[model samples]
Target: MEKTLKRLSSIRTESDILREFLAEFLGTLTFVCIGCSANAVMLQMPELSLINGPLSWGLALSVSIYVSGGVSGGHLNPAVSLGLASIGKLQWKKLLHYFLGQYLGAFVGSLLAYAIYNQTIDRMPNDITWPIFGTKSASHINAGSAFLDQIISTMFFLMIICSLTDEDNPMKPSKGLLPFAIGFINFGSMIASFSYNCGGALNPARDLMPRIMTAIFGWKSAPFAYNDYNYFWIPIVACHLGGILGCWIYRLMIGNHWK
Candidate 1:
């Protein structure tokens, strides 16, 4: 018992905790900014095309996780953090801090995206151009379809995350594979989902901050139609529910060994 206690205590320290928080903040910020900014740039380029948007996002997330996984477990998405918590991989006490960090990071990232694209936005022929790459609109589906898409996509995303990170997976040789697996998953999911109907933002933080940024910038210039701003809640609530469902489903299939 004494040896076990020592092992537990030795795993982390207060400084480690502080560093994790900072890493989470900066890593998430970098991811959203770079990914969204790339999308914005693509929108201005007639040669780029919409098909490349999702791929760009996938690559951005993959690179960010590769760089940040060592420090904060690479939880740039609030849904991912919540899912991990439900699976007992993350402490409940730190949930609020992680959520706050991710949200703030995303907000800052959006600001950066806006800043970088300000010139392009100003020169755009219309506000509709902004929604082409951002998360504020769903050109591919209607409201009902958008909600459903978010739910299903988030479910799959969380399941993949839980499975890849699972230690019991005999297939998983080492942690080195995690970033690549996660990146590929994101890339595949985006290609499958993102289109005219919303940008397939499987992440609540990714969706919310950009919407908030659009609102702050004024609806006239905002990309989304905003017929019902409350509609945004669907992604927020559904994503969390999807995360919980993913954790439960993984447990059902693989057993509760994750605990």
Candidate 2:
């Protein structure tokens, strides 16, 4: 405990903390903006959605990480930040700072996307535009199943991330290529599962903050009222659970075995 405190103290200089905050903020903002813009584009081009949605999101994340990784380890997602903290890879003292940046960034990103696409959005129906900002469970699934699906999706994502960055893992990608590799994971995950369930919101910030924007803009009750409000909270709660679970499983099965 004493050693942990000392380590945290040594790194908690004001400048360092501020840099981390800004890095997370900018990284998340870039990611959400690009991803949402893609959604907006897909809104105009429905036939190409199968090829566009996952690919755009994947590239957005890759670029964001490349931009922020040097300064802050590029944890653009609150789920990733919390998961790393749970495993002691991130100091708990910095978690709130990270969360503040991530959430605010997401909100701003959503606002930016809306600003750019409002003209188009205005012409479309609210039901069509809302999914670009937030997520909705598919008609076949209830809130419970959606919740479980998110947990599993995020769990798998976090597990792969943990493995990719594990210092002791023999198969980890080179540092320069890690972001793209992670991006591909996201792309593949989205292709396989993002559409089938709750639109693949592996990150809460990606969903909740934008959802708030939609509510305030013109979406009103629909974003929250969809699925009787039961589905609105699933990604936020389940992803955190999934992150911790993923890290724990990795630690038990692989991390602990590293010599």
Candidate 3:
């Protein structure tokens, strides 16, 4: 009887963990659904998206975090989770769970967005250089500039994220407001970087899964190439490095000072 009770308790604990993972999956899905779909609308109808793109994405992200923050810390982006883990604020063991949830969520979320906007996509001009579901560099920015943009912007992103969540910081935001602060920072980053063809893809799952969706939809290898250069690797590699760098910088500046 005692052993059976212990087994039942363990099962309940496992069930709770699964629920947390489900929360992350649903949160990320909602996050990318809004972000990617907004970009899709911009691609098809720039007029409608011009004013709403950055703001809507930021607000959607805030909502995602608010919905799942208590259960999973609402790490809808892999880079954010990795950054926190690199700083010892998040357990490395939990990374696999978070990543799996985020990637799958982003994948399905983007697909859902595509389903909503396929009509507009079909009507795009052949000259329509805007991305459908994947990121592409703008003409003014070459591969090098685009890569630099992602790396540096991601550094700023993770730095702010870490600072906001830093326990040692005297001005940490209350739980209710942290998501808004993050959303504002994300909006600021987009306003600053999106014009440069950086695509403002701070998360690999956000970039790659949608790209995969495009590929599945028959865009083929084009989503991975821009300016006759294969740039698929830039955002993924740079953001991870940026996260590590941000964690290092934060540790040097504040985390290391903690007793």
Top candidate on TM-score is: 2
For model 3, the superposed segments whose C-alpha errors exceed 4 Å read 1-13, 48-50, 125-130, 190-195
Question: Tens digits of per-residue lDDT for model 2 on 1-259?
Answer: 9999999879755688899999999999999999999999998999878878999999999999999899888889988989989999999999998998899999999899999999999998887789998878998898889989988888888899999999999999998999999889899865346557778899999999999999999999888888878898998999999988888889889999987
State the C-alpha lDDT per candidate.
Answer: 0.73, 0.90, 0.79
Evaluated at residue 243, the lDDT of candidate 3 is: 80
Candidate 2 weakest ten by summed lDDT: 189-198
lDDT of 1 by residue, 89-198 (tens): 89988887778878888888888888878877767654555553346444445677777767777778888777777778766636887877787778776544553455
Once all C-alphas are superposed, what RMSD does model 1 give against the true structure? 7.5
Using Cα atoms with residue i matched to residue i, what is each candidate's TM-score against the true structure? 0.84, 0.93, 0.87
Off by more than 4 A, model 2? 1-14
* Pairs in steric clash, model 3: none
Residue-wise C-alpha lDDT for candidate 3, range 1-259, written one tens digit per residue: 9999999878644565687678889999999998877787676567876557778778989999998899999988888889889878889888888888998998999899978887777675422533655566677777788788777878888888888898788888998999998998888765445645766788888888887887777576677655675577788888788887887788888877876
TM-score of 2: 0.93
Ranking by TM-score: 2, 3, 1
Once superposed on the true structure, which residue ranges of model 1 sit more than 4 Å away at CA?
1-14, 132-140, 194-196, 218-225, 257-259
Task: Supply the TM-score for candidate 3.
Answer: 0.87
